[model samples]
Structure formats: structure tokens, C-alpha cells
Target: MGAEGWRWQDSWIFVSLVIAGGAGRHRRSAATRRPEGIRLTDVLATADHLNRSIPERDDVLGAVRRLAGAGLVTVTDGWFRVTTAGEQLWRSRPSSGMGTTVDTVQKLLNRRCQPGDTDWTLDEDEYGIAVQEYIVRLLPRPRRSPETAQERAEPS
Candidate 1:
């Protein structure tokens, strides 16, 4: 299965994985957090890190865009920063609930879309994205199952 669907999350160290090991390293608290904006190499690095058997760069990009669009991230020239919004979103989530599919979509999105040359204000189009962003935030798949094994186990 691609990174797009539900998969086993190493529940033992879920927090570290969810934030891509960047959350705690960058912050003392949510208020004090600053998400480094997008760096091409960084996104590529993350893409490589998440590059599983399935080519789900699209999914990963979706995740980044959601985070960035939601005010969770601030993408500047060559650097990506996660803002307070991001820390809050990541931290507020339950450590052990099934992650959301919306998150999977966002991840893919992030993997694909690079940050614009300058900082962007989230607009109406982005608002639509934010809706997905919020849903994805509410639930992050890959971090947890988006669906059940039974769903996949059964043949169509």
C-alpha cells in the first residue's frame, strides 16, 4: 500500500514521527514556536524520508500545504518555519487516536507544492485548502489508521 492509505504507526514513538522530529526540536512551547519556512532541500529531504514503497509525494505535499496554509507554517525563501498554529495543531492532537485521512491528503499536497517565492496570505482558494487542512489536522493518517484492515483486506 502507498503512504496514501492507513498503515501501521509505531505507536511507541508516535509524537516524534508526527511532527517529523521537527516539533519539539524547534520549540520550548507552542507560543514560542517558530516553524522554519520551506527549503527545497528540506522538502526533498522530508520527501525522501517519507518516500515509502508507494510514491506518495503528492500526499506528503498535501500535508505541508495544509500546515503552511493553516498559519501553522510560514514559508519564506529557501526556509520553512512552523508557526504557533502548527505547534498547537500538532500538540493539541491526541497522542493515540487513529490519525486522519485528511492529513494523508495534506501530506501528499505538501510533498508536491513548493512554497511561493514570498510569504502568502491564505486566500479564498487557500480557505478551501484550510478546510481540508483542518480536517487533515483533526485526523492524520499514516500517523494512525485512516480506515480498517477489513476495508483493505476484502477484495472488490
Candidate 2:
């Protein structure tokens, strides 16, 4: 995909690597100045910890593939490391507003019901429904066309 086509999952995976210290300059041994990268397991664990929920392994792999395809990350011998381009992308992300979706989702998922509220227990289906409701509410509504808005304003 193009540079502007980064998905939230992609940003989250990249950020997780950065947060885990798998990106940027690393302290190197005097003899061998090689950079260190984290393992795939570490990435998954870091992402899970950051989001407070387990991310699907397949989804993480998919994001890695996309990042790799974009030359943002490199995978070698089971180690994943961010490329220079990736570091640049991360550094400039604040101006591009890339992490908002991940932040919003993290906040929503981390929200807990108050102690005095009704029992927070939920079955699998109930949890699914609740999540769907939240997603629907959070998504932006499409704007109506000017003609449609005028027609509605005119009333029956």
C-alpha cells in the first residue's frame, strides 16, 4: 500500500515494536556494533500489554507483512526490526495523526465499570453485542447531501 494508507493495526504494531525498544539506535558492544531487534513473541506480548487485550496472532502477522512490504520494517531470522524509514515514520506520526485510532480503542477497551454499578459479567454473545454497540456509536455518521438536507428541512 501507499504511505498514506497505513491502518491503525499497522501503526499499533509499529509502535509496539518501538515501545519494546526494537527500533532506533541501540547500545552496541564495542567489538560488534550490530543493532538488536526483538522477537515476534515480544512484539505480540508488548502489544497485548499495551492494549490490555490479546491481539490475534494472525492479525499481528498481517500487519507485520504490510509494514515489511512498505519497507517500514524488516524481518530476519524471526527477529523484527524497524527500518530507518520506519523510524522516520514513527517520528513524524504525531503530525500525521496516525495513532489516534489506536489510542481511542485502547481507552475504550480499558474502561471498566464502576464498583457500585450493576454486575459487569457478560457472556460471549453479550460482550460481542456490547462491543458492536460501542463501535457503532464511535463511528462517524455519513453526511447527507445538500438536497437531502433541504428536503428534510422542508418537512412533509
Candidate 3:
């Protein structure tokens, strides 16, 4: 299918498949290796880890079905693997940021409280603090350039 048809969930699932060994081995190792596809259970685990929330089984299955229909992935004996087309599509996907840090942090917080009591809910101030802490923990600090490092070493 065209890249235009891909959704964020679909892309995430595709990536999971690829990381699970869907793309097979490198050219140099192809002769000595065989590609192993992932099972639905494994995919579910991966989704849980990535999304930080348990996803509906049907939702994941639907995404896999769409990918199969597009010839981007293949299924055999309950295992799923990415096709060459899928790899190509993955490589060509836009590198732009998909969402802001606050949005992601909020989603994570929401998931954490989904099954808990009302007392687990965060107040506005608490939520803001949580978001800030998560963002700081999640995003990497910038590195100094070589020129800047040299200048700092030399002092003002």
C-alpha cells in the first residue's frame, strides 16, 4: 500500500515486526541464517512496552490484517513477518516529530491510572509536575559542540 495509507499504530506495529526479525538477515549472513517471524502474543507484549498501555487484541490484529492486505507483511502459522515492501516503506517514512513531549507524558500518566481508584488521579498541579519530570527523564540532554567545548576549556 501507499505510505499515505499508514497510520501511527500501523507504523508502530510494522516497526515491532521489523525489530522482531521480520526483515530477515543481512546479505552477508543470509546464507547462514533464516528469518523468524513473531507471534501475536509477542506483538502484544511489544505493543504494551511501546505504548505503555495494554492494547486491544482486535486492534493489533486489524493493523496486521491491513498490513497483510497491502503486501507489506505476511502471515504463516500464526507468525507475522515484514516483507521487502514494508522495509522500503519504513525507510521512506517521514522523520518529523509525531507528537509533543507533553502529549506523550500525559498519555503515559493516563494509562498508569486507568485501572486504579479515583484517589490515584492527579490534580492539575500534580499532573503538570509529573509531565515535567517525565519529559526531563525521557528527552536526552543536548551535547556540546567541539568548538563550544574548546572555548569552555579555555575560559572567557
> Which candidate ranks first by TM-score, i.e. highest?
2
Q: Candidate 2: TM-score?
A: 0.51
Ranked by lDDT, top first: 2, 3, 1
Q: Over the stretch 1-156, how does candidate 3's per-residue lDDT look in tens digits? A: 233344556546655665455342235332332466665555655555566754454445555666676667777765677777666655444443433322332333233222111111213453345335544555788999999899989956
Clashes of each: 33, 0, 0
lDDT of each: 0.41, 0.55, 0.51
Backbone clash pairs for candidate 2 read: none
| TM-score list, all predictions | 0.37, 0.51, 0.49
lDDT of 2 by residue, 38-141 (tens): 75556656666666654555456556766676666776765667777666655444332333636542233223111111111223553345345544655799
Report the C-alpha lDDT of model 1 over 33-116, residue by residue, as the tens digit. Answer: 334433333333333344422213333344445445445555565355656545555555434433352354344334443332
Give the residue spans of candidate 3 off by over 4 A.
Answer: 1-6, 22-34, 94-156
Please give the lDDT score at residue 57 for candidate 1.
Answer: 36
Q: Please state the error at residue 153 of candidate 1 in Å.
A: 59
- For residue 65, model 1's alpha carbon misses the true position, in angstroms, by 4.3
In candidate 3, how many Å is residue 67 off? 0.7
User: TM-score for model 1?
Assistant: 0.37
Which regions in candidate 1 have their CA more than 4 angstroms from the true location? Answer: 1-21, 25-38, 51-65, 97-156
